[model samples]
Target: MNSRYLTPLTIMSLAWLSACTPTRVSNQVSIDSPAQWQHAANAQSAETADLKTWWQGFNDPLLNELIDKALAANHDLKIATARVREANAMVTGAEAALYPSLDFSLSGGREKRIDRIVGVPSGQGIKLITPTADAVSGGLAARWEIDLFGGRHLEAEAAAAQAEGSQEGLHAAQVGLLAQVATNYLELRGVQQRTGILQRNIELQRERLRTLQVFLKAGLANEADMVRQQTLLQSTEATLPVLTNAKQNLIHRLGVLLGEPPENLENRLAGVGPLPKATPTMPNLLPSDLLVQRPDLRLAQSEVSAAAASLGSARADLYPKLVVSASGGVGALAVGGFPSLAESVYALGSGLSAPIFNAGRIRAHIAAADARLDQVAANYELTFLLALEDVENAFVAHRSARDRFSQLTEAEGSAEKAYRLVDAMYQRGAGDYLVVLDAQRSKLAVSDERAKAETAVSVAMVSLYRAFGGGWTIHSGIDKASIR
Candidate 1:
């Protein structure tokens, strides 16, 4: 049989053998288990519409801009993108294993030598000079590892799956950055609003203290009353600096997220208004959507797929590997004064290698692959369950904060009216200073609570978006643009 035919024949036999026993495990887990996500009767129905551009629903231009900046420049996100690129390169390398590798070389050299005859009696004691000789050679060589055992295919598949997982990991990183930016921005604004409220209340308390001092001098109020009012005013004034400092810290964090110096944002945001209001209604993302939307969960799924492919590759290693090799070359040479001679040569070869003994290493590899696959399978399920829990928790938080915000809004209105009424009554000496002070404290408390509630709602919405895996998709048909 021709040597060239051996590789193909061996590959065919190995492929036939592999097909005889399809190596696989039946314990692969499903992407989602319906039993785990049973819906409650009173559960708010999640939106069925795809939330591809969920961030736009917030309707805040500043938030939209911040998210864009973070996606473009966040350090962790860039690292994740690099990982995806690396994975893609690995896939290309793995695929190259399936095709023949060809190389070519060309060379030319010249050499001169003085000939000395020692054995020839006639040439003894005589020095002979030889003309310089030149030679040229060229050759092409080819090698191919025939994937008779499906090892190369499995490797390529695993690499491709890993590439996909890396892409999803980038998406996950982006989603996380978006959530952080949104949450921080909301917090900054919340702190700003509270600071503004505190400042105003401090000014009001100062005015009240002045009034009390004046009344004390006029014998309308005692010195003890004046001191009590002064103490209350000082307490309110003390909180202003702490809240201001916290707001500045958040601004610095936002600056880092935007990939700029922290001090740079201070000037731009010096006169900026408070954080934008919360969206009117929170997004309702269903549990089922988490599977398709969340990048982390998708990444976990890809890992499971890669692990399965690895198991295939390990099983393939138990079979023989077939290889085909070919080489062709031409050379020229000169001897003494004779005419130059030229020769050409060509050759083809094939090989088969099987692991007959390795102390059960092959079996151990298969078992290890299987164990890894099992681990990823469990991780995938856990990721899904965690995502569901996040959604549930976000839903509960959003609803609770919304309800609390409504109550605080009402309480703030009532407190404002009560403060006005109490102030009027105190001026007419019909109400005590204690009533005025109590009303002022109530108003400040209600204002602070309302601000907190607003921030809570915004943060909860961000959590929901994250749990649903929002902001990684583009409407464009190109798949690369869809990845972060």
Candidate 2:
């Protein structure tokens, strides 16, 4: 406790104590976010979404099942999981470098020699020496570098941050995979519905063609009417193949998403199901909610932490390093039919390596690390801004799509009523055949638009969920050890 008794070694130890402790990495960063969404006009509910199973809100059991399957079997998710494991391994290895390492080694040698000088006995060597000998040795060695400047600690810190980033990456992948599966499934259903609508119209036209043919035979209608009806039927039939092809592609894509072969679902999904309905109200989230919810943003922030730790490590390189090493072993030399006493050997040493003149290599490394930190900082900010933009964009798209779907549905209903009235008038000879055909066309077009609009509404909802970084897998346990 006496100040006068402080030694140079004590002062150096104090310096090491201050310098070797790694600075902590912040797990969260601050970003400016809007309090409310840009397009909130048509939103039915202000409630926050249940992002973990947002697809279930559509009330489609099949959709929910598909999302579950994708989460379990998706190849991209598997890859992300593997990366997380790899990062975890790296973290452990980096940390291990901060502690002492022990190694084992063994060596043995045997040799025989005969004296060629003329003597009383040809096989005899020098009288005082052995003609053959064998020696053996083994030992445990240890080496430790004292982290006087926090170099090893910072390396471990950087690796730890990277591991956390990989965990976030895995979550990000889950979010993307679920959203993709849901969107593709919705589009497939939409296409199927459109195909059904076209088929119904084609059948109606075929029946009209038959009636027109009878009228021509009875000399009441011209052959031109039957030909026109036939042409309409053929054109409508032609569109069926396109829709079928699109459906097939979607099925194949979905199969791949679920980690199955493309043709694996050909027999199972033969029938079309109704397109998923959008939830009437979705929970709105705050801007700050995105920072915690969006895995990409979290991953980006982790990258910043890693880069900062790396800079710390690089700066530490400019300081001196202390290495402690020790080794000990026992060995015996054996002569022909005899043995020498075993000798014990041991060594312990401590050394310091200070960067004297390295042609600015260490400085360059420090500069590079600084640049990397700056890059990641910029990237983190970019990611935050992009996340906000994503939410706003998805909100606008979702609202607009809902609006469009509503308008299209109303238009389709009106067109269908008009078609029915025109058909009745035509049957009574009060309206021209042209009027009926025109009304039929209008109804078909409106119906097709309505189906597409429905698909858009659902897809936009998926986008909104994805933008919010809302994906919950059983693997996303709250335990930090689980993530590692």
Candidate 3:
């Protein structure tokens, strides 16, 4: 190389290096949130409990046990945890790309060659020559891609963000599973309560039927009235099986959620238990808190971060790349019976490649990356909005359910009083049979509604905790290995 030309080339290379400006995507996101929750205005003024173990507030030991088991054994949670591990491995791989690679190679071979001289003296006719050689070589080579524009670093950043997103996904799965287990358990207990109500009502109807039979035999009651009482008794009995089936199905679902067979929990849950009650007061939280509390929202933010890093990486592709490589080796050669000769060898080189022409291939990648960033940003905003919706909806549902349960409890007490009064009058032969029957029916209906109302309150509480991303903090140590 001539110094005259080398001077200009060196200057140009330095200029190129100086022109490589670091490009990065903005990761800051802002969301418009209300200062206070609209639905939380009328919430009860009680002490707020820890949202981490919100299920325990129901005071149901069985429910708490079931949730703990599900958290450790659920299949969906295991799968999500696996994904987190995989994403973490991908981060390591992307980071490795910024470092140099080294490899060692060894080879040995034998080569033979033969030559003939045809134009020698006529007396000699032809002269023949043969050469043989054995050669062995071994080397270590290394290559490194210089991070000129931070492209490799951006790739590692993208991978790290993805790993965080996957971790949030696992938390989301845990939240969902906990909610599912609680909802089903509450519903099952409610079903039992309703079944008990029906059974008691059937017995009352049976007693009434017997009384009517005796009255008819004594000519005090008509046969038609007795038959009507019989029909009511049988009708009440028919609904019992529906509740039975529902209870069985719920137990099966709970079993499956706990990673057990459908019938595994039937015996354990066979005994009827009272419906769980939710706390009257709601958790103390602000709208902005969801940014950190809700796993889905956090996951969405991570997605945006990963996408931004990816866009930056794509932009870096438009810049020139620098690779430095080196190799060192020893070679041995032997010819015929001659002593083997060994020589040391080494080499160092560098290459620079720029996208001089490709019909817009690099630009196309940048454009795609930009679009993905936009999409992820939009999704992040949407997730935040949806999280707000969840919390507000949960607030409304929980409050309304609690209120309904309170009102139904009052109604049930009054109905029971009325039934007792009517039954006493009928026993004294002063009240109509039809009125007695009506009173009994009202009491049963009110009791059944109250049971369902209680269940609704508990289910709503589970939803609220899920919206708040409860249960994840407590299970922070949870992982694929831990679960297994």
Candidate 4:
């Protein structure tokens, strides 16, 4: 080969080799962390499985209907769906950079120039006539940045990761909505049950007050006892308003969750009964299951992946870039001419550019990306740990509440029997009025405690389902199906 050509080829080969050199490797770490309760043996064998629709187990038609409506019309859900669409569009935009960009342009204009002689007599100066000319031009231009160092590829990869992250975020939003709706519904039912209990106790107190008044009239009980009974009845009556207010508040919250006004739901739920019974005991999976089913965790993981890709893209900027450009056009300068006097012009060219200096901006970007990846990795780990904590805490709560409900039920029954026996004795003149009063109070206390215990059990089950990443029918809804 000639010396000059050989030198140029050697330099080109060196540049190619430099471009091939590895600049950075991804340091993304897995997000899965073992639960505190999970044993080593179980951890090793753990694997994520498909998520199930756990809420259907409740078998409440009203709850099912509300959840369906919320999924369709809730404002927050609409926002999340819109975010997913925006992310998908961003992915498309990033992928577009991998190909050539072609643009078309057209222009038409006329210009006239007047010429006058300088430093000449006004009369002697000849007036120069200039003709107006019209120019019309149209062209197609193309430019492509050759991905010589994987910059465009890295950018596309980062964008794809972000899109996936957004999808996971949407799922997380759905899960949160499911949990909120369940919590609000359970609270509403609990309040209703409490109100019913209060009403029944108030009626019993009123009856006791009447009985005391009759005894005082018949010289069987004193005025102090009658007054005490009257006070108790009034106190019990006072509780109803507070309970009613709480119940109404919960209904309003549910209305918002369902994307409707409270008045609209009042009629629909007028006959709705107490909260459903306990959720069935489903098989509990291992903690590692969060990696697949917990959308927030997956979103964090995707963020880490995106950060790693971004680092790669930033590092690619440290090296040289290659670009190819081309333009083709047909133009005419003649006015009122269609295809006549038209001329064609075309050109093709290539260029190479390297970042020589930019006040350390490129290095800072690469470092920022690296830091972001680290931050995402840490966040992922934290999310995994938090998920594990949630599952174990929910499990403990469910078990504790379940046992408490059983014990309270037994206690309430015993109290009811004792109260009945005491009441009969007092009615037969074998016991004092104080005994009847104490027994009745005991019965009311036991009943209230039992009702509260039942509510706790239901709420705990909801928490367990949420912590276990269950509930929410992912496939039945329109957004779930049309999102992709």
Candidate 5:
């Protein structure tokens, strides 16, 4: 029998004929993690993040609209979604490699010249060859490569892993985009609040200037005092334009985030709004949960899986490749002065190819694939470490900001009380206008700090939510399988 007719059992039994790598691929890779988070001090609450629109906890309707628009229209996210579709197609193509392929062809041609012939006809005079001949032929061919080592199946698995990784990458992008939007929105609000504080303080300083002018007229104030109050009033007014410019720039950033032109969102967000109020602590965040909650980590792990399956596919290349092909056709030749006969033709074949020697090229391929697996495994481990660091940093920073905000809020209240008392004393002629002016400045400074601290806490919370990799769960249909 021809060597091509050898069955897989015979081939494996004759392993001394060629090199064979181990066919078994293990799915085991270890990552050690802690049981609980170390920075869960202020986050003692049991409230979990609302997986279905985590931003809604802010209770800002415009924020909700912006997030919805970003998810629907963000161009980077749309490109990531397209990558997922491409991965899905690759999986289908890999699966197609396991099945037989059929193709068809047809041809017709005319030949005008006939060469001199010397052969005699059987039991008759020599027959004259035709000067013009018409020929027609049609054929059907089928080919199949028998995957004796499951290489094609492993390639399909790798494609599926790539598809899963693409999905996690999309989710991570959504998480990042949400975090950016939240940060910009809260900052815009904070700048507006500070600008408002400055405007109000400017008005108070102007009133004090008016009072100073009356004092000068009554021989109780000097020219220096009137000029001093005027200077303070104008100085306080100077900061508003800078703050207003920053706020408008933040609005433009938000407009682009929502996939709109910069000029389109000014009217809608023109009115100043208060900063987002900090909500109760999100619950159920632990170190071990980061493995599942972080989409970037999930993507890294999926990439590792793909690399492993691809390594298996490359290893399979060390063995023989077997292919079977067959073709069948009908042909007819017609001469202008003679009858012609139609004939049936057929052919069958099988091919077995093994890399006998190629200067270790196949081995190099397997080595390269194994190296990729190692690279992805390292990346997966680093991603886990980064995930832990992100959650811990967010927790500590948020708790510190929350605590600091509380202290500044108390200070703001005290400062406001002092300002009111000084104003009352000035009205009854018991306090100097300079004293009232100093008290007002103190109050404004504390109020601005408090607003900034509030915005910081809000932004910190957004960072924590982003670290927790809350699922968007928007299935593009092909991403049904959970990441392994």
Candidate 6:
């Protein structure tokens, strides 16, 4: 190579490279964290509860078992896990760009040709001759595209960040799945409790109907009274089917969540059980904790990082690329009636390619990457705001549910007492059927409300823990004591 011809081109390439030095794109977003939660009053007890195992506080073995089954088998969680693995593989591929690649090849061929001899010795005229040739070749070639502007490194960084985001996505899926299973389970138990209340009310109403028949035989009660009592009993009976259907639906949903057929758990969960008890207790938590605990927020943060790195990688496209390649091999060839000839072949070369004109394609890509960076940053901020909303709403909902349940409990007891007293009076011919019916209706209504309220409290707690991102631990291991 002539120095004179290469000197100017090398200088120009260096100048371009100097101007294209890759810069790091920052993905940091501004977020103000509150020092304390707004609904701190709802959680008066300061005892640190391990949010990771918060469901254990319910003290229901069946509930814990269901959650375990869902975690092990849920389809959504498996999908998230696969995504994480894919992202990790992408990271590996991107990093591989930082190194060189080598390849080996071998080839062989034979050719034959027939020719007529125009001039022949010893008066031999137009003699025909056949000629054949053989060739063999083999080589090893290597190529490397040097990361002069750190473009490949940026790509690897982006891939790593995406892998992290996918991991957080898996965690988010786990958290949501656990919450769903717990919510449905609590609802199922609540329906069962309400059903039991209706059954008891029916029994009481049937006894009153028997007393009325006795009164009618003695000329104290009329056919209209008997008809009214029968109507109340039938109305209570009608409600049972609705509750039965609801319970069955919930069981089906739970079974699917656990990766089983819809009807698989019917026998297992058919027996009625008491609803999980609510403690209404939570550890002291601050808004800042969400940054570390909440998977969605973490996922958003990772997205911002990935977007920023992608922007940097795209910007590297504006610069020049340098590729170096080398090949070494041996070749052998032989002609008909001639000795074989063999030679060693080798080559070393390098090239520099700078983007000159592509109809603004590179610039468009850079602009798109910049736009994505901005989008992810904004999404990160929005995610934090939504996390705050979720926590605040869960706090209020859990507290309100607990309060409503307490009030309903007292009302149910009073209604039951009233119903018993009115029934006693009517049996003694001191009260009418209307009074008994009113008391019976009130008792059933209050009892049902209390059961639903109790379930609400449990479900609210589930929502609160989910908002806190409690059900998942980092694959690298998390500090359980600190996260509590």
Highest lDDT scorer: 6
Instruction: Order the candidate numbers by lDDT, best to worst.
Output: 6, 3, 5, 2, 1, 4
Predict model 5's lDDT versus the native.
0.80
Off by over 4 Å in 2: 1-19, 22-30, 41-49, 113-130, 215-231, 278-281, 335-339, 423-441, 473-484
Assess the local accuracy of residue 453 in candidate 6 as a C-alpha lDDT between 0 and 100: 94
Report lDDT (CA) for all predictions.
Answer: 0.77, 0.79, 0.83, 0.75, 0.80, 0.83
Where model 4 places Cα greater than 4 Å from the true spot, the runs are: 1-27, 35-51, 115-128, 335-341, 423-440, 472-484
Ranked by lDDT, the better of candidates 1 and 2 is 2
Error of 6 at 82 (Å): 1.7
Worst 10 residues of 5 by lDDT: 475-484
lDDT of 1 by residue, 234-336 (tens): 8878888898888888889888888888887787665536656546345454465566667887788778878988898899888787777999999898755
After superposing candidate 5 on the true structure, give the runs of residues whose Cα lies further than 4 Å from its correct spot. 1-24, 42-49, 113-130, 213-235, 278-281, 474-484
Whichever of 2 and 4 has more lDDT, that candidate is 2
Among all windows of ten consecutive residues in candidate 4, which has the lowest summed lDDT? 475-484
197-260, model 6: which lDDT tens digit per residue? 8888788788778888999999989999899888988997898899999999999999889998
- In model 4, state the lDDT of residue 234: 85
| Candidate 2 structure quality by residue, lDDT tens digits, 1-484 | 6755554465457446735455333333445656566665433323333667777788888777777888888899999999999999999999998778999989989877666222233456534443567889999899878788788888998999899899999988888898888888888989989988888778767767877888799898898777878887898789888999999999999999999897777776658788865463465677666666778977887888898888888888878877878999888887665557589889877788999999999899988988888788888778878887887899889879989999999999999899999999989999877578678877988898999999999889889888987766333322122111
- What's the number of clashes in each of the models? 0, 3, 0, 0, 1, 0
Q: Could you give candidate 4's per-residue lDDT for residues 1-484 as a string of tens digits?
A: 8975875575466446545535545645744354435421232322223335566777888788888998888888888889989999999999899788999989988876555222323586854445556788999999877677777777888898898888877778788788788778877777777777777778778777887888889999999988887887788788888878887887888889888899998877655377787464543575655666678777887787788888888999988887778999988885332234679989877788999889999999999988888898899788878888887777778778879989999998898899899889988989876677678777877878888888788778778777766643333211112111
How many clashing residue pairs, candidate 1? 0
Q: How does model 6 fare in lDDT? A: 0.83
TM-score ranking from best candidate downward: 3, 5, 6, 1, 2, 4
TM-score of each: 0.86, 0.85, 0.87, 0.85, 0.87, 0.87
lDDT of 3 at 150: 76
Error of 1 at 422 (Å): 2.6
Q: How does model 3 score by TM-score?
A: 0.87
lDDT by residue for model 3 (1-484), tens:
9977885586457545534538678866667766788988733322223666888888878888999999889999999989999999999999999788999999999977655222323466754435478999999999977777878888899999999989999988988998899889989988999988888888878878887888888899898888888887888898988999999999999998999997779888988888765452357777776776778887888888899989989998888888878999999998764578999999977789988898999899999999999998889889988998999999999989989999999999999999999989999999987578779888988999998998898888888888888876732321212111
